[model samples]
Target: MSGRFAPYGWSLVLHAVVVALLGVSLHAPAPRPQPAAAQAEAEPIQARAVDEAQVQAEVQRLRDEARRQQQQEEARRQQLRDEAQRAREVRQREEQRAAEVKRRAEEEQRQRAAAEQERKAKEAAEQKRLADLQKAAEEAEKKRIAEEKKARELEARRKQEEEARKKAAAEADLKAKMAEAQRQMEAEAQKRAQERARQNATLVQQYIADIRNKVERNWLRPATARPGMTCTVLVQQLPTGDVVNVRITRGSGDAVFDRSVEIAVHKATPLPPPPVPELWEREIEFIFEAR
Candidate 1:
């Protein structure tokens, strides 16, 4: 009744008042005889007067209720507007806070990005430094290896030179010893040759005599041969005392005697060896005489 229901109450009251007037009008008697009609009209006028006063009271109550309801509606509308304003202020504050948070987050992200970039740069520099160090170490290792190789080569060459010097010295000493031995051998050989010549002086004559006797035994006298026939024969022999060749250096006057003498020498195929190897000769000469 204080708000939306006030108008409804006013309408109900007005309707009730109309219904009472209608009933009164409907129940009133028809126009009566003059004296009775006047009395009935007077009673209806008094009843209408009472109904009009009630109607005025109801109208006043309706007016007062409408005013109260209007005031309450105005207050409700004012409260709604205040709540809406508060909501707007709160929304604005939230927007401001959100903007500030976003700005801070963007700043932090930028700082983190800068730090990450710096870290990557430092890592790259460190890697390059390590690579340089490794390269230097490799170069040092190569230098050390080269130095060791050079030292080894020098040592090997020194050993080879030492060995060569020793070999040359040994060869020189051997040559000197061989020269001394050769001189001694030559001296001994000359001494032995003189001794052999002295010893073979008589043996050589006997060897010739033995060869003449052998030829005489093998000879066949020719019919034309004569006493006093004398010839010097040259004979060639081998180391085994085998006759290799024969010739008459001096011949007898008769051809038959000369041929017979040459045949006799040939018939003595193998003669005799010398008593000493030094006395052996490849050639021998002898005189043949027919007595």
Candidate 2:
């Protein structure tokens, strides 16, 4: 309903009801006639028809007013009903709009929450990937370090083995050299003693004469000396003018004669001098009969 009509509409209805009530009060029913007043009023027979007509007209007028008032009341009530219906439709429309806004708001909230969840998931995945990469790198580094350590150990072992081999070789060489040197020394000493024993008897005939002189007078041998017979000797001398040797100065066999000659030499230890000191010799040669 229009603002201009809604408030005034009820007020007009109230004013009409008040006016109807006043009309009813003013038009009260006629009272009963008194006998003397009735006789006096009966004397006006000439105006009776006009009075009847006027009364009929008055009754018709009152009936028409009641019909008009009823129509006005019905119209006022219908207007009020239409205004109430319009107000109800307006309220319904507002409520529907409010519901639509609420639904949209709810949808927006859901979308935002879903987006946030997705974002969080993405971030978590990234972090996990980075962590995995770091772990892999660490493992690789560890493997590399382990391999290096193993290689170093192997190198150390190899070095130790090589050192041991070198030391062993050096020791073996030293031992061999020492043994050879000792043998050489022994040979040299023997050679030295032999050289000291005699002036080298280069002439075979002289060597045989020297052997004869060292033999006993009773010892006998063939006149012709052997050829290609050679030997060597080692000796220890006593401080007395006598010599004691493990055996005689070199000999080819004829052992009996060799023993006899050695005995004679021992018995005549303070040997007669050679022709001169220049001819003196610690070694002598002996040649014997041919076999």
Candidate 3:
């Protein structure tokens, strides 16, 4: 029995030492001891139980914070994706706007070029029309000049022909007038010659009167005498008679002169001019002188 009791005591002592060491290590910052008065005021709790409850609460708080952080990271990622999509849309819209502007510029250039070509073509047509009109006017002027020249030539020829006809008519009229004047002069000369022959017959009668006056100078017969004496004589013969009688028709009016005149007459029987055969008696009377 002693030996058993001794072993048991030693075991107890060892166990006690182990329990004290575990308690100190397990609860390093132990709860402070309550005052004697306070100890009686409330029921005492196990230190280990309080400690286990505090540790469980801390662990749960940590898990809740980690879950919140994971939710924030996911939200940020979704926002970044949305921003990138919007940027892509903006870039495509800007490219389309630039293309539209370029197309409008090209269309305007084409319109301006077409308008310029129309203007130039209109100017060219106007110039050609004016040139054609001017050419027509010049041709008309040339035709007028040619007609005038031909008219002048025709007029000159007509004038020349008229002058030639007039000259020929004047020359013929002059020749006819000259022939009429020459005929008139010849007729006048022939009339004058006939008048002169009548005058010559009167001279023969004067010669015979002078012979009868001289033969009756002494005979005073019944005859007439002026201061400038005048006389007449007659002679006759029968068909078979040899002698003819002489008679005086004019004398100085002396009776004795008549006898002397008879003797003188007998001396000059048959006077200077013989008697005409057609007249049996030839008689002559004369004006002895002119006053």
lDDT of each: 0.79, 0.60, 0.54
How well is each residue in 149-216 modelled by candidate 3, as lDDT tens digits?
A: 88888787777777777776676666666666666655665556455434444444444554555455
Instruction: State the lDDT of candidate 2 residue by residue for 1-291, as single tens digits.
Output: 365355455555655655565566457665456598576775564365465455556555555555565566668768777888888888788888877888888888888888888888988998998899999899999999999999999999998989888888888888889878987887887787576545444332353354445443534443433444333333333433245553656665656555654565565555444443444446544443322
Scored by TM-score, the top model is 2
| Model 3 residue-pair collision total | 6
Model 2 misplaced regions, further than 4 Å: 1-39, 42-93, 162-208, 213-285, 288-291
Q: In candidate 3, where is summed lDDT lowest over 10 consecutive residues? A: 282-291
Candidate 2 colliding pairs: 197-282, 197-283
- Model 1 lDDT vs. the true structure? 0.79
Q: Give the candidate number with the greatest lDDT.
A: 1
After TM-score superposition, the amount by which residue 174's alpha carbon in candidate 1 deviates from its true location, in angstroms, is 15
RMSD of each: 12.6, 9.1, 23.0
As a TM-score, model 1 comes out at 0.36
TM-score, predicted candidate 2 vs. hidden true structure: 0.45
lDDT of 1 by residue, 31-140 (tens): 55558757767777778768667766665665566566556666766776787888888988888888888888888888889889889998999998999999999999
